[model samples]
Target chain A: MKKTKIILGIGALAIASFFMVAADHIDAPAVASGTADITDFYAFQAEDPNNVVFVANVQGLLSPSATASAAFDENVLIEFNIDTTGDNVEDLVLQAIPRDGRMYFFGPTIPGSVGVDSAIETNATQTSVAISAYGEAATATTNAGMKFFAGPRDDPFFMDFAQYGEIIAGNATGFNSPGVDTFKGTNVMSIVVEVPKTMVGGSGTINTWVEAKTKQ
Target chain B: MNNIKTILGAILISAFAFNCSSDDDSNNNEGSMSIEPDFSGTYTQQDQMGRPAVNTVFVSAASKNTFNVTTPDAQGAAFQPMFQANLEGLSPAFANPGDMNALMQTSADFTGLLATDVLNLSLDGETTFFNPATGALLTGRNLTDDVITIELLLIFGGEDFTENSQLSNDNVDANDKPFSASFPYLASAW
Candidate 1:
């Protein structure tokens, strides 16, 4: 048990180290090369208020041509952490990984540990969903009263980089009401799971966050 | 009569000004504060292309000015969410080919998991080319072996931005950041 704790602590430390890499906002000549680095995370209610969607995007500012050939990281585990209570701890988790051409999704199940260390609860009512190989190909899975989708598609984040630069240079003070998006006409990999409102929590406000777990 | 009228008007104006000022002072000021992302915690992931992904994960941070992880979560469980590819469009995010290689986050209308579509991928897109084995740039994606544009999202959870404060934002991500002409990989932390 003590060894398990140590492993979890080390994993948390590593994650803590990388967590601060900022979204795509370049200023220095040296770091400017990595703007394609990941920029943000979004989670919200779907069109059908009954469900919640979690979206994670990476590799910002690629030329459409460059974005075309990008590949995915096989070692990373995209895990959605759900905190039914206000404690900011994950009560249930859903993880997604790709094997071959198909993307696989697991859970809505309770995680063994809520913070640093996590083990797949294989004993739980596990569900597997295949990703739509093509973009926007609609394939769904109903698990724990939720629907899941794993696949690739277009990039959504938008920004007017020129305008942002102008603002940063002090030429302009503030951004337009809704600033321009530089990420328009791009693409990203997407994994989606729609869970019933009840599954999330008792309808009261609950804070939910997403995490990417790796094998230590 | 004109002098009297002018004097009376001045007094009336002063009274009106005072009344307005008082009213303004009593009015409550309300506004929402953006939850600053904490720059300290870890939010990193590997690409999908590499057969053996980065043995070590990389932290993807937000910019110092825009985002930061102010507080770290006390309880564990939630790992920093990572994208598989860049998704196009808003909400009901449509996937593309960016997920396999990197996590792309920016403040825009559209964002999603990190992978782009096979058809949309480009020669520069695959991880096998740069990350080799892992960085294989896709071929036959378009008329030319071009680099596909990708979008990433960086979330620092809750951050603090007070009027008077200094911060060390290592994770620096932005649209203006550079890219390699040939093959390359990028990482950051704020």
Candidate 2:
């Protein structure tokens, strides 16, 4: 009963990233409903069309023993906001930050400027990797092109809360189409990253969002 | 400063003496067990009571691990935004929207096994969040607007990719199972 750390943005101007569910767990009065707090965000175009991919999820019903020592809140700074020509503002910028466990990527390059206030191009170049250790498998693979993973999986989200609670108790008739999946047997706590679509845009239509910046 | 105010007054009485009253249960019984809140809906591969299980898969991956999962294009993504948040004072039957939430939530999630099918995986270790009213064990420390779900297991493609692990390998496949996983997608927490 002492919460006070929410700062989600949209048209207002932190823009991009405000929950794109693949995983969602909110209620009990919308417990910090930061854009519904996404559990999945993926962008495509990379078999070498240049390269692009981004995943963002924040503490959404985590388990597997609290995602086995959950890490990556080093003040939180996982911004992968890019909006090209759609007038969403952000032209091209890719940022990822995680201290010790190693996950420090930044930009596709050009960023002396790009909507709002994002100054950390660090010379329009930066990359640091090493955050895949929790059930191990990727002991050093995708670097430069980018790669990083934080623990705990499963919870890819599936629902049917008792017939969606009998269609909000109207008795029924609305859901049941693909219903009944009361979180199978839940779990959450994943923060993965894989990029290479020539960075994030060198293809067709574009408009992306993923943010969780907390360092005041 | 007076020995730092006597070690911050003994760490605030040892953080309220870390509670130890033999405890009883009483989340107030708001929703009694809470199950309906609204998060939109869509999930195949049944079996919780309604039957039908397996052959409901949706996989998406560009995973290399450095973080860049394309964005949208999952298939137009018209609206994948599920919403509903209300737990009234947090616990004790909660009472409000159609009332009946005493809070005892648990949505564990995690076990994207691989490393050799985690040696015929089979481990369902449990730790699915806790709060039976005021027992409190919420993840992310003191969980508030709590509601979370995620289960996306995409073992391997292109020949199980021989060997290339990095989930902080304890030798990979650290079994804590619910078994039956065949990649693609599975994000839970409705």
* Predicted model with the maximum DockQ: 2
Say which docking band candidate 2 falls in: incorrect
For residues B10-55, what per-residue lDDT tens digits would candidate 2 score against the true structure?
A: 9988765533211222442553432222212221110000001100
Q: Give the 10-residue window scoring lowest on summed lDDT in candidate 2 chain A.
A: A13-22
DockQ of 2: 0.03
Candidate 2: segments with Cα more than 4 A from true spot? A1-37, A40-55, A58-94, A97-147, A150-155, A158-162, A169-179, A182-190, A193-216, B1-136, B139-190
Score chain B of each candidate by TM-score: 0.15, 0.14
lDDT of 1 by residue, A91-153 (tens): 777766555445556677786666544555555555566655433335667757766665444
Measured by TM-score, the strongest candidate is 1
Off by over 4 Å in 1: A1-38, A134-136, A171-179, B1-71, B74-190
- Top candidate (lDDT): 1
lDDT against the true structure, each candidate: 0.39, 0.36
